[model samples]
Target: MYVTQASWKSEIFQVTVGFLPDRAQIGALGLVVLAVLASWVVKLRRRLAYRRAVRPGQPVHAARYGQGRGADHLGAYAPQPGPDDTRA
Candidate 1:
């Protein structure tokens, strides 16, 4: 009617281990891992193919930054020009 803490812990451990997966479950887990690896391989192949298709020594088109007047408006630390400022 009254179980000690040690015995109760052992009982819980036995129940937990009893619920562990069998060989079939382990095989299913392996299959899932293989599926994920295959997906990553396919993605890597596509990325490699795209990189190969791009010509070497050609500049990749990307947005140019800090070229416009708004570049100075980024932070409070940036210097703000006044109407009377004459720095050319």
Candidate 2:
């Protein structure tokens, strides 16, 4: 059994002193460093996974860049006619 500190000790000093809990102080530098390291690890893992998924000489995002904007799909889609001829 542990004895807790009294709220008010002295009768003469009847000041309102509530509960005070003992706690360990931690520095922000360590936490910041840890967070930064975790973020870096996550980024590295993502990079490695991407590399494994997309091998060399292969398009990473074929759908996005293969036949992107202004790409004529085998004459299936033609570019919209520009305003009047460029002879103006």
Candidate 1, 18-79: lDDT as tens digits: 57678755676577689989999999999999997785997776657745455355778767
Predicted structure 2: clash tally: 0
For model 1, the stretches where C-alpha displacement exceeds 4 angstroms are 1-21, 57-88
Model 1 has how many clashing residue pairs?
A: 0
Candidate 2 per-residue C-alpha lDDT over 1-88 given as tens digits, one digit per residue, 9 for 90 to 100: 9997655544222232212222211334356569989999999999999988877776565456555445445366766547984521
lDDT of candidate 1 at residue 17, scale 0 to 100 = 54
Candidates in order, TM-scores: namely 0.40, 0.34
Q: Model 2's lDDT to the true fold? A: 0.57
TM-score, candidate number 2: 0.34
